[model samples]
Target: MRASRFFALRERGTDARTEALGGLATFLTMSYIVFVNPAILSSAGLPFDAVAVATALAAGGFTIIMGLTTNLPFALASGLGINAVVAFDIILGRKVSPDVGMACIVLEGLLAVVLVLAGMREAVVRAVPTSLKLAIGVGIGLFIALVGLRDGGIVVNDPSTGIALGDLSTGPALIALAGILVALGCAAANVRGAILIGIATSTVLGLVFGVLDGPSAVARWPTSGDFSTIGDGLAPGALRDALTWALVPIIFSLFMTDFFDTVGTAYAVTSAGGLLDERGEIPKVRNLLLVDSAAAAGGGAMGVSSVTTYVESGAGVAEGARTGLASVVTGLLFALTIFFVPLIAVVGQGVTVGKDTTLHPAIAPALVMVGYLMIQLVREIEWDRPEDAVPAFLTIAGIPLTFSISAGIGLGVFGYVVTMIARGRVREIHPIMWMLVPMFVAFFASNWLSAHVF
Candidate 1:
C-alpha cells in the first residue's frame, strides 16, 4: 500500500495540509520541553546545550517512530515529572551520580518493553472505568490549558488568592489575549491551520510590537558532545551502588509513574483523536506501547530521563488530527529545531511581561481553545450512575487541581472502587482493579514508602 493509503487520509477526509497543520499544533504546544528538560537536568551537573540537543532528538526520533508504526497521532518525549524526580530526588538528594540515573532509566525502560512483548497490557486498560477514561481525556485538556496560561502570563500564581488573573496590562498578556481571540475566531470560521496561524500571528505581532525580540543566531547547529555520555558511562561502580534493595521502591515508583502516566496520556490523546475502539480501548495497543518503551530507552541512552507521551498532543487532536501523519509532521518539526533554534525561540521562548517581565507569550490561545474542545468528552460519561459520575468527576476535577495526570487517575480509581464496593457491587470489579487499587495505594503512600523502605 502507498503510505497515504495506509494512513487512510482520503477515507478519513483529512488531507496532507490538515495533517501538517495538526502536527504543527501538537509540536507548538509541547515544544516547551526542549527548553525545560535541559534547564531541569543541567541543575544536576549535566551540560545545558547537551541536554537540549538530546531532548530534541529524543522527542523527534521516538515520536517519528510512533507516527510510522502505529499511525496514532501521539508524540513521546522525556517526561516532565520524572525528570525532576531523577534530578532532585535521585541524583542530587541521594548523592547518586547522574550516570547511575541513566542506568536506572535504561532498566526501567527495558521492563516496559518486556511487559509489551509479553502481552500483559490488555487487563490494565480494561481495569479503568469508561467514565474515568473520558475524564482522563478531558482532564488532560484542562491541564494543558492551565500550563499554557501560567506560561503565557495570562494567569499568575498568587500566594494569597491561589491563582489570580495576571496583569493583562503587560505586553505578553496583551499578546496572549489577542492570540486567544484570533485563534478562536479562526476556529469558528473552520479555517485550516487555525491554531498554527494564530501562533504565527502572535509571533509576528510580538516582533512588530517589540514584545519578543529575535534570537541572535538565525540558524545554528548544536555544539555539544552530550551524546558521548550515555548509558555506558557509569561512574565505575556507581550503577551497582544505585541498585541495592533500598533502590527498589525508588525504581518501582519510577516504573509506576512512567507506566501509568504514559497510559493516561496515550488514552487521553488517542481518545481525543477518535482512535479508541468500541470498548474505549486502544486498538493494536501492544504495538503502540513499543514506541513509548523505545523512546524511554533512547532517552536513557541520550542521558535524559524516562521518556513518555505528552498530553499536549490532545491539542492537535482537538484541531482535527486523525492519523499518524500528524505525529510525523510533529516529529519533523521538532527535528528542525536543531537548525532553526532562533525561529523556535521567537515563538516557543518566553516573552517578557508582568512586573518582573518573566513570562512566555503567543501559545496560550491554542492551548485554551483546545482545552475547551476536550471538555465535550465530559458529556460522554454515564452520569446517571453514581459509580460513574463520582469517579468521572474526581478525575476531571482533580487533574488540573493536582497538576498531575497520574494523580487524577489514582483518585478516580480510588473513588470508583470505594463507590462500587459501598454500593454492593463488589462482584463488578475487574480482577485487575484489585491489582490497580493496591498499586494506587502504594503510589499515594510513596513518600512513606521512601521514608520507611528506602
Candidate 2:
C-alpha cells in the first residue's frame, strides 16, 4: 500500500483507516492547546494572537517533522506546565521582561538541542529505570486528569477547602457530568472513537440544553503572528539581563522542567501506542528527541514557549495508530486550524465563568478516559521490590501532587537512590543517577527560595 510504504503501517500492525481515525482522535483530544497556550503566555505580556499563531505553527510544523523524519506516531506542541513557568516564574516572579523570559526558554531549548546532538540526551533517557518510566506515564496521566476534572467543572476550588465538588446545578457542571457518562458508556461498550463520540455528543447537548452559548457563525482565518521578539531573546544584552548570578537556579529550573516534561510525555504517549521495542525503548528515539528539541528551539524562534511532545497523542495510539500517518493527520489538522480559528474559538472556549472555565466537559471526557488507559501501566510494574515500587509510587504520585513532571521524576529518582543506599545496594545506581540527585534538589530549593525569600 502507498500508505504502508510511507508510514510502514503494515509492518507496525495498523491500516490506513485506523491511523487516520487515530490522528483525528488525537487532534480532537488536544486541539484545546491552540487556545489555552496562547491564553497563558499572554499573561506574561506576550501577544495572544502571535502566541496562538506561533503555537499552531510550532505544533503543526514539528509534529509533521516527527511523522516524516522519524516515522513515529508522536505529536509535539506548546507544553502546559512550561508555559506556566515561563509566565509565572520567569516573567512575573522574577520581574523579567518578556523578551528576557523568552531568552531563558531559548537557552533551555538550545541546551536540549546540544544534549540530543551530543547523544547526552539518549544516555540520560537510557539511564532511567523502566519502572520509573512507566511511573512517569501514570503520573502524567493523573496530572492531566486533575486538569480535566477542573476544566470539566466536576471539581472546583473552595476558599474554605482547597478543592471540592463543583456546583452540580450549574449548566456546565451538569453537561460535564453528562459528557463523562457518555464517554464512559461508549468505552464500556467497546466502541471505537468512543471518546470523540462522547465529546461530540456532549457538545450538542451543551448547545441544546443551554449549557454553552453558540457562536453566531463558526469559521474564519486567524490573524497573522508577530515574530517581533523571536530571536531577540538570546542576544548578548538579553543574555546578560537574563543571567544574574542569582538566576542560575532559575535557568537550571527552566532546563530541568523542559527536559523531563518532554521525557515524561514522550514516554507516556509512546508506551500507550505500543511503540516500544522489546527493550522498552521507543524506536528512532534519537530522532524523536532531536525533533523534540528542535521543536522547542524553533518555538522560541517563532515567538512562543517550549514545544514538546503532547501526551494527548495517547488518544491516537489508543485508537489504533501505530505509524506516522496519524501524526501527519494531527499536524494537518493543526495547520487547518489556522483558518478555522473562529470556529475553534467558539466551540472550544469550554465554559468560562469569572476566569474559572470548566474543561469543555465535552472534551474532558477524553482525557479522563485516556488517563484511565495510561494508568494501566501500574499493573505492569513489579510491586514487590521496595526499591522499585517505592520510587515508582513516588514518581506517580508526585507528578499530580507537585504539578510538575520533572519534580515527580526527581522525587522518584531521589527516593530510589536513597532507598538503595540505605539498603547497601548503591553500587547498582547509574553514575548519571548520582548527578541527578543534586540537580533535582537544586530545582526544588531554588523554587522554594525564590518563593519564600526573594
lDDT score of residue 353 within candidate 2:
67
**Cα TM-score per model:** 0.77, 0.83
Looking at candidate 1, the ten consecutive residues that score lowest on lDDT are 226-235
What stretches of model 2 exceed 4 Å from their correct place? 1-22, 39-50, 87-101, 194-211, 225-241, 245-250, 265-280, 315-320, 350-370, 447-454
lDDT of 2 at 320: 90
Task: Report the lDDT tens digits of candidate 2 across residue range 367-389.
Answer: 56656666777887889988889
Per-residue lDDT over 1-454 for candidate 1, one digit per residue giving the tens place of the 0 to 100 score:
4867978888777877888888988897777677556655766777665667678887998888898898888887788667766876778877877878776777777778887787765566666676776787677678767866775778888999899998888788788778877877987896655666667777788888998887677777766464555554244465576577666656666676677667766776777677888876787688787878767766877887887888778778877888889999899888877665556556655554436545557766656665666676777788999999988889888878976666777888889999999999999998887787888787778778777875
Residue pairs with backbone overlap in model 2:
151-358, 151-359, 152-359
Give the deviation of candidate 2 from the true structure as CA RMSD: 3.7
How far in Å is the alpha carbon of 138 misplaced in model 2? 1.7
lDDT of each: 0.75, 0.76
Off by over 4 Å in 1: 1-52, 71-108, 225-258, 261-281, 303-306, 309-330, 350-358, 366-370
The local distance difference test score of model 2 is 0.76
> What's the lDDT of the predicted structure labeled candidate 1?
0.75
Candidate that would win on lDDT? 2
